[model samples]
Target: MAVSKKRDKNVYKAPRNIGKPESENPKWLIPTALTMLIVGVVWIVIYYITQANYPLPIANWNIVVGFVFLGTGMVLLTRWK
Candidate 1:
């Protein structure tokens, strides 16, 4: 008696598309904005709490950094469609 060999059934197929199209809604916008806002608020609070032990220049720098995050979040929200 003779037996036939079985062919391999496992094979990989290439994707038709390389990347996601721009037409899809970017769902990350809202969550990212919220994160930025929360981070900014936390920075401001930390700066205020430590201001008593730090120099004026350092405190000012922290305030500026916090505002930058808030501003960036606002800008991103505005651009959302």
Candidate 2:
């Protein structure tokens, strides 16, 4: 049996932005996400540690506030691509 040494010349090329540094990621994405997440957790933590003083002194409002921040962060993550 004999074999042929022919190769396919057709190749696919990806878009330019695929490897560009500018298309890596949005500048405020990570920072904003982190800020919301961290602030939410910290606020809840502080609320728990300090009953009614500093930050928000409202009763049980801290939970709602924390959740809002956390939810916003999660929403932002969805549009990362």
Over the stretch 11-34, how does candidate 1's per-residue lDDT look in tens digits? 777787756564754899889988
lDDT of 2 by residue, 1-81 (tens): 899978777767778777546555688998898899999989888887887464677778878999999999898787676
Model 2 stretches astray by more than 4 angstroms: 1-24
Per-model clash counts, in order, read 0, 0
- Best candidate, TM-score: 2
Where does candidate 1 stray beyond 4 Å? 1-24, 52-57
Every model's TM-score: 0.59, 0.65
lDDT of 1 at 12: 78
Q: Which candidate is the best by lDDT?
A: 2
Instruction: For candidate 1, report its TM-score.
Output: 0.59
